[model samples]
Every structure is written in structure tokens, then in C-alpha cells.
Target chain A: MTNIIWGPMIVLYSFITGLVLGSYIISIAPTLFKMRNLEGISTFSMVTAWGFLLASPIPLVLELGSPLRAPNIYLYPTPSSVMALFGYIWIIFVLLLTTQIIIHSRYRDAAWFQRASTGISAIGLVISLIFGGYFGFIIGSMKAREVWSSTITPITTILSGITAGAALVALLAIITLRKDGLRKDALNSLGKLTLYFLAIYLVFTLIELSTTAYAETLTWTRLSILLIGYLALSFIGVQYILGGLIPIFMLATEKVRTSTIGSIVAFILILAGVYSYKWNLIIGGQQIVEVSPQLYSLLNFMPTQTEILATVGILSLSLFLYVLGLTIFPIPEFKSKR
Target chain B: MSKYLKLQEELPHIVGRYIDKKSAKPKWVMVVDLNRCVGCYACQVSCKMENGTPYEFFRTWVEVIERGKYPYLRRVFLPRLCNHCETPSCVPVCPVGATYKRDDGIVVIDYDRCIGCGYCIQACPYDARFRNPYTGTADKCDYCLHKIEEGEVPSCVINCMGGARIFGDINHPESIVSKMLAEKSVSVIKPETGNSPSVYYIGYEEAVKAGAPVTVINPKIGVVKEI
Candidate 1:
């Protein structure tokens, strides 16, 4: 029997990594572009990215059949392997982020440090963009799974990541920013960014699905399974309706965008939508068996209790670290001069 | 000297006696005659016993592909294993350089070095590789390398009751595999993958194309009752 090798753990890892990449972009973009509205949450976004980044690899390590042997990726580097590139990319990105955070916190007034931080932020932005779309490349390179082997997968991933990242930063900004410090325009900017990205993601997804359906190739059967079969609820219902349409509708309206509770609900739904999209991409991709026309039994796709616990546990640890970081680090007030 | 070291020293001489000296390196290949496969799964059972493959995992297995309908119904036994392709998709995608092709043309996994990332597993279009539960490493048929080094055929080849499985060095022009490949019309599974698989089948297209809704029978339980 064919089993789904990369399951819920992989889905969780991909989702978290997307968030880390997206948040890193949100953290660095304001200073680089000099967006006044986003500047207030720049440092806070960097801290948030750091928290998620630290915990991102946990699920991946835990998912490995031999966790201790993970270091072998670096030890016996396969230069040709796309997966081998992850270690190098991740380490470089982490170092860049750390240096930028340290410079901003400790050497904020130093002329050299300011220049250094800006240089680092520019480099980090490119790396974050790569990191955001890298997971999609991992899935895209797998020529076997038709659903994931599309050229558009990486673009969709980056767009969805940006959408989720903007939502998360907006949510946190609303919760943490003082009444005097908080900017309605800043939240509105984030909302507008999210709407645009989410719209693009939907368009790209529609193009992919429509083309696959029209092709009538071997991929069509698999696409059918995702569209109207076992994964239909998760793919269409959660990813599109609850996650995509509801949030887009809510964010589109000025009343909901300005209201505190309305924005919170929309952001939460967008996060859920992004998570569901990842789940469908990773877990759903593996559901189709290679040799047979038959899809893998639904029973095989269910995550084990350990997998559920590990996913929840890792997320909890990341949130804890983020909270602790906010308290430990001296984050300058939103209105403080740069 | 260690047994492996001693064996390594003696191996060339042992193989040289049986294999032609003109062909310095043996390019191993298998030819599966689908017409001769009797659906007896002796290769499947012997493979498990020989390799100690984990339950629900296989180094080699027989797939019963049901073709046609009504009076014309036929079950084609397609024996599946790692093709050890000329350009293996699994090799390039391995994060750790654990899986590689030997000079003699066998794709083997270095278990000690494998980190079990499952990237190679995903890259392989054949669905040949699997995670060895015991070793926590990628495992697949290596043409039974230990047996080959000692101048013996793979367990699947020797145990195949129908004599459908043929293993030999294609580099040697006189080898049975080379002769069959030259004389008979043979095909490889999923040639579209561009893996250029070493395992060639004699009647693949006719058997596979004459069907729809292909289902895989469990290799362990060889029984499939006629509908």
C-alpha cells in the first residue's frame, strides 16, 4: 500500500517557515522602502520573525526518522540536491537577521551601525524572499507529484506568505500598540497589502486549477481528487471560502477594516486560510499514488497523536519565545525618533 | 584483515573468472519477461527473506495489473524494483550523498551516511525507494550488491519460479541481458521520466495499456480473486 510519506509534520513545517519568511519581509521592508506607516512595527516584526525562525526547524527535526543524523545534510553535502541547499540558506538568513536585530537594539545611534543595519536589512530582504519561496521550490522540483510540480507553485507560496505575514503583523500591532501610538492608516496599509496579495494568490490558483482540469492529462485525475474528492473540503471550503473569501470580503469593507474586532477576525481567518493552503499542498500532494490510478486511502492521511502534539507543542514554544523576546529586548516606542 | 577487506581483495579475481576481461566494469541490468511471469510471487517472498525488509516495505515486489474486462480479462504480473537507472533521479536530490551509483552501475545507499530526509524518496518517479523502519534510512533494491560481488545473481532472479527475471552485465555483449535487449523488443516502465532504467520488460506496453483503473495487489498477500 502507498503511504503518505510527508504528512502533517511537513505541512506544519512549511506553514511555519512561510510565516517566518513573510514576517522577516514585513520587519525589514518599512526601513528599506521608508514606509512611514509600517515603520512603527518594524522592530516588533523582526522580533516576531526571530521567534518563529527559532522554532521553525523543530517540527522538521522531529519529523525525521533519525533526528540526530540531520547534521549529515551539511557533513556529506550533495551539491546537486535542492534539499541540501536549505542548511546553507537557513544559516545565512539567521545570521543576517541576528546582526540586524542586535545593531538596531544596541547600536541604534551609531552612524556605522545604522549603515551596517541598513545594508544587512537589504540583504536580509532578498534572503527572506528566497526563504519564503524556497519551500515551494522544494515541492515544485519533485516532478512526480503533478499537483505540486507546477512553475506557479513558488509564486503562489510567496504571495500567500506575504498575505499571512501582513495579517499577523497587523493583528499584533492592534493588540500591542498604545492608543496614541497606533495608526489606523498603518493597519489600513497592511489590510490593503493583504487584499492585493490574496487576490493575486487566488488568481494564480484559479489559473493552475483551470489549466490542470483542461489538460485532461494524468494530473487531471489527481486534481479531481483535490477538487471534488477527499480533499475537496479542506482545499475549497477551508482554504478558499472560510480563509480566502471571508477575509477578502471583511478586509474590503471600510467598516470592518477600521473596527478592532472585525480586523482581528479577518486576520485570524487569513492565517487559517494560509495554513490550510499549505496543508493541501503538502499532504494533499502525497495522497495520489504513483503506480496506480487509485488515491491512497483516507485512513493513511490522518495525523497520529504524536504528530498533533508535536505541531501544537512547537507552535506554543514559538509564541512563548516571541512573548519572552518582547519583554527581554528594549523595543523603542512606536513614536520614538529613528 | 577484516572479512570485507579480504573479500574486496578477492572480488576482482572471482568476478574476472566469470565475467569477460574486455569489459573491465560490469554494467548490471535486469530484463523482466512479463509473458513468462506466472504471478507466483516467489521473487517477492525471497526478496523479503534475503533483505530482511520491514513489514509493509519492499526491496522488490510483484504488481498484478488487471487489464481488459469480461471474457478477455487478464492479470499481468509486473515485478517492480529499483531500476538503478543510468541517470538516477534519486541520487541528485539526496540532501546527504548517501545514495550513489557504483562504477559497476549499481545504485546503492550508504546507510551510515543517510539522514532520512525523504527527498530522494520523493524524487524517484518509480516509487522504488522506501524508508527502512529499522535503520531509519532510505532502502531499495541494489541488485543484491553483496551477492553480485561474490559472482551470484540477486535473490529475486534466482528465486523467480518462472525464470522471468534475468540479471547480467549489459557491458558484456555475450551476457543474457545484452542478448535479450538486442534481440527482443523490451521496454522500461515510465520512459517519460528519462531515468533510462536498467530493468527492461518484454511486454510492458500491451499489458499496461490494455487497462484502466490500475490497482496494486499487496505483495505479501499474493491472492487476487477473479471478479
Candidate 2:
């Protein structure tokens, strides 16, 4: 049996990158769309996005067999390579985001900064969209893997990212914002955004699954085995029932959307759901062995101890950077200033 | 001298008669006669010894596929290696152009340049590539370019006990591969991929039919296992 080449590290890396794009969108939506509901937490969201962005490459580098040679991707880039293009895109996005954060934090009142911020936010939005879909494109382009080779893969990835990102922002906003500083309208808006995006993600996922099932090809057979066989609990039970349906129902109700505890529970579920989606896409896709009728034993693809450590370490690093940013940046007091 | 060396010595006249001078570069191709392959796995053993592929990793291997049931059961040996396609899927996905197709039509990796991200391994339709655990780089069969440059056939071709493998420059119309292509009905794997693989197989349809239950046997221990 051919062992899975890309494993859990790839899944985590994709998830973190999605979060980076999602948080960045939430940060800039206030300025770009003039959504005053997100205004209070805009700077906080940008900082969160920046922190995750800074930490995103850690898992990717750690996953490489020769980590020291990663710079070769930049030096000897093949233009035709989507992965090579991702390197350039990541650098450009990072620079744009950093510049936006600097301007928004330090020079918010300057007329020049405002104009530059608007232009940068517009560009950043496009880049984040690409960044969100980048991992999906990587998987989708591999024609050998039937489950991953779908036109809807990138769209589902972007929607999941937005849902997870909004949930993360909501969860953090509750934790960091002073009780008096917390605005009901902002939380409700974030809850509503998460609900809409999560619902869209669910619809696209169902469409992808149904389309795969509709075909009489080997794809459906393998996917059916995946859905009802070994991965049933993770793919259907957790990802759909607990993470997807429960959260959607919770967020849809005003009683749950307006309450701190209820919204927090829903956001946490959304985050878990998104992570499960990435897990299913990366690990579950690899489980369907192309050459053989038998699925690759999931036991083979379980993250090694080193992989698990690296995932935890990188997640901790992202959280550390976020906390550090909170301490270092002079984020204006949201209640009084905004 | 090997038969390939003898053929190489006669290449000038062959090229003069068959190939245009401007396009005379050797385009290597392999033709596997499934009819002749007896599942001896001499090629698989020789490849391991020659290339020093890491444990549990293969540069070339044969898959033993059994079809039908009970009285009608039959086994087919499907020998697999890199197709070294005219348009390779693995080539364009490399973040660092560490893997590329040579003008001679062999797909090769620059080991020193590879970061071992395994993207090429994932992109390959045939599962022909692997990340070398010891070297920490992507490695695969390159038609044994080192041997070929010295006017020798790949180790696998030379060691195939059943004479099932034919390796030659298709650019020379007089080459064995050209004659075989002209004489036999052949098929390439995953033609829908648009990779234009250089490797050709006789009896490909019967041996590699989709949904055929496959069993990979380890030649070393003669163990039958489903992979």
C-alpha cells in the first residue's frame, strides 16, 4: 500500500491559512464595506489575522523533509507551478497585511493613511481570497485522487475559512473585550456571518458529496466507503451533526445568537467543524487508494508523534503571537474611541 | 558490449535514414510486453540493488492483480515505473523546479535542489515517486539516466529475466521500441491525464482495467498482500 504523502501537518497548515484569510477579511470588511457592526473589533481582527499569518509557515516548513532547503522555492521558482506561485502570493499578502495593520494602528487619523488603507484593503481582500482557496486548488488539481478532483473544492474551502474565521473572531472578542466594551450588535453580526457562511459551506459540501455519489465511477464507491465505513463518525457524526447542524441551529435562534454562552458554544463548534472538514479533505482523500480496491488503513496515516507535536507547537506559537500583539499594539479602547 | 551499445554505435545511419537532424535528440521510451512478464521480479530486485532506494520505497515494482473467481481465476502482472511523459503532471507542480523532463524525454529530479515536500509524489498518477527517507529528497526511476548516458539500458531492463522490457530511443525509427510500436497494439496508463506518457504496454487493457481487484506481492518474501 502506498502510504499517504501529505498528512495531518498539511491539514493543519491549510486550516491555519484559511483562518488567516478569514480573519483578515473580517478585519477589513468594516472599512471596505462600511459595515459599522464590525468597526469595534476591526483592529483586533487584523492583529489576530497577522498573528496567524506569521505562524502559518511554521507547520509547512516543519512538514518539509529538508526544511533548510525551503528557500529554494523562492530562488528557483517554476512559473507554471501552482505551489511556486503560492510562495510569491504569500509574501505579497504578508507585506500588504503588515502595511495595513501599521497604518490602521498608528496613523488612523491621517487622510493619506485612510486613502492608502482603502486601496490596500481592496488588494488584500483579493489576495486573501486566493490564499483561502490555494490549498483546495492544490488538492483539486491532483486528478488521480477522485474525491479531491472537484470544481467545488476551492469554493467550499473559502466558505469554510470564512465561517471558521468569523467564529474565531467571535470567540476571541468575547474573551478579550471588556464587558462594557463588548457590543451586542457586533457579536450578533459576527454570529450572523458565521451562520450564513456555515450554511453555505454545508450546502456546497452536500453538493460535492451528492455529485460524487451520482456518478457511477470508482469515486462514488470509495466516497461511500469513506462516509459509511471507517470515517463515518468523523465525517458525518462530528463534522455534520455536532459541528455543522447543531451550531447552525444554535446561531439561527436569537436567544442563542444574543447570549454570550450560547454564541461561544456555537463558535467553538464552528471551529471544530472547520477543522474536521480539513481533516476529511486531507487525510480522508488520501485513504482512498487509487491503484487498489482497498482503502489505505487509517492507522498508517495517523499523525506521528513529531507531527502532533509540531501541530500543537505551531498552534501555540500563533496564539502566543496574538497575545503578544494585544500587549504591544496600542489598540484604541473600542467603547470610548469608536 | 551490450545490445544497446551495439545499437547506439549504429545510431548515426539510423538517424540519417529516420530522424530529422534538427530533432535527432534521443527520446527514450520503454515498451513492456505483459505477455512475456512472468512476475519473476528480477527488475524490481535489480532496481533496489542498483538505485539503493530506501526501505519500503520502490523505484520500480510489479503489481500482481488477480481477476475473476474460482475456476476462471487468472493473475496479471502489471510492472510500473515513471512514464516520463512528454507533458508530466509532476513537473509543473514542483515549488522549486527540482524535477523536470529532459530533452531526451526522461523525467529526472535534482536531488540537491529538492526540499522533499512530496508534491510530485502526490501529483504522480501512477504512484511512481517517493520521498527518500535517508536522503530526504524526492526520488524515482529516471530510466536509469546514468546507465543510459554511458550507452547502457536501465538496470531494470537489463535484468528483466523474461525479456519483458524493451528500452530504446523512439527518435530512431530503427530502434526496437519503434519496431514494437509499429507492430503491436499498445496502450499508455491514464491517457485522459493528457500527460502523453512515453511508456507503452502490450495487453494493457486486460492487465490494468479499472476496478480490477489488485494485490501487490512483495517479491522478496513471496508474500501476497493487498495494498
DockQ of each: 0.41, 0.44
Candidate 2 residue-wise lDDT, A17-82, digit = tens: 889888888998888999889988998899898889888887788778899999998889788888
Error of 2 at A145 (Å): 1.4
DockQ, candidate 1, vs. native dimer: 0.41
Candidate 1: pairs in clash: none
Weakest 10 consecutive residues of candidate 2 chain B by summed lDDT: B14-23
TM-score, second chain, candidate 2: 0.84
lDDT of 2 by residue, B1-93 (tens): 999999988874453322232226788899999999999989988999999887778899987777655776678888999999988989988
User: For model 1 chain B, where is the 10-residue window of minimal lDDT?
Assistant: B13-22
**For residues B1-227, what per-residue lDDT tens digits would candidate 1 score against the true structure?**
99999999887555432333225677888999999999898998898999999888888888887765667677788899999999999998888888999988899999988888788888888888888878888899998888877777888888777879988888888888888999999999888778899999999987777335444464533333322
What's the lDDT for residue A101 in model 2? 73
TM-score of each: 0.92, 0.92
TM-score of chain B of 1: 0.85
Sort candidate 2 into its docking category. acceptable
Q: In terms of docking quality, how is candidate 1 classified?
A: acceptable
Question: In candidate 1, which residue ranges exceed 4 Å CA deviation?
Answer: A112-114, A178-180, A218-220, A293-299, A334-338, B1-22, B211-227
Per-residue lDDT tens digits for candidate 1, residues A26-93, read 77777787777777677888888888887877888777778899898778877898778878888888
